[model samples]
Structures are given as C-alpha cells and as structure tokens.
Target: MDTKFDLEKISQNIVYVKPVVTADLPTEVQDQVGDLDQIYAVHNASGEQLALVADRKLAFHLAREHKMEPVTLH
Candidate 1:
C-alpha cells in the first residue's frame, strides 16, 4: 500500500524557539519580564508567536508538551 502526504501538513507540527530581547518586546511584556535581558519565544511553522517563556529550556519543553517538534533558531 502507498500513501501520499502534503509537505505542509507534514511540517505543521514543527515549531521554533528563538531568543528575543526583553527590551524589544512590547511595554506590557517588558514589564512582565522585569530584570531579564532576554527571553525565549516559541513560533509555529507560519512564524506566529505561540508563547513567550522565560528560558530556552522552558520554551522547548512547552512546545513538546503540546505535541510540537521544537527546533532552535540562533
């Protein structure tokens, strides 16, 4: 038996974790991350930010918890 799959569907579960500057974030977000210079952001395949975590580990962990395959972006 053979099956065909769409590339877009295959990559739907992939997400990326990238470091973001706290200062560059919105005023409300900056206020939430007080005293921290950087944070991590989890983004989906379409580049929409899903969540903002305090550290890289948490970012990846959160993605996995939601059944997403997380990759690091530098």
Candidate 2:
C-alpha cells in the first residue's frame, strides 16, 4: 500500500460534526421537526451534508459505521 497516497486521501475520509439548534431555524422547519431543540449535523470534509442525528455520540458512531474518521467542527 502507498502510505503517501493514503495520507493525502485522509481529508476525504473525514466527517465533520456540528451542533444545530432547532429554535434558531425557520418556523416551518422547527414545526416539522417537532420538539427537537438541538441536534447534530454531520458533514463530509468537502462540506456536503451527510446526516442529522439527535446527539453527538450518534454522529460519531455514524461516521465510524461508514468507515470515516469523525471530527468536531468548532
């Protein structure tokens, strides 16, 4: 295996975890979500949204399940 090539691919193998506040969201979205005040947003290194989970642990768990490293964004 090429370690140098693998190292360069690390960025694509990362997932970003961030917190989202339903209260700060649009009223229609907030209403649609129903009682979720806080949630975790998972994104790829390229800034594409991956998933929205209920908690931090689940967010990380999801990344691992998909074989990607999970990282906290801010």
Give the alpha carbon lDDT tens digit for every residue of 6-61 in model 2: 76688879999999998877787777777878988899988998998889999999
Model 2 residue 43 CA deviation (Å) reads 0.6
| Runs in model 1 lying further than 4 Å from the true structure | 1-7
Query: Residue-wise lDDT of candidate 1 within 1-74, one digit each (tens)?
Result: 67877878759999999999998999999999989999999999889999999999999899999998899988
What are the RMSDs of all candidates, in order? 2.8, 3.0
Query: Which stretches of candidate 2 lie above 4 Å from their native place?
Result: 1-5, 26-28
Give the Å error, residue 1, model 2.
20
Q: Judged by lDDT against the true structure, how good is candidate 2? A: 0.88
TM-score of each: 0.86, 0.79
By TM-score, how accurate is candidate 1? 0.86
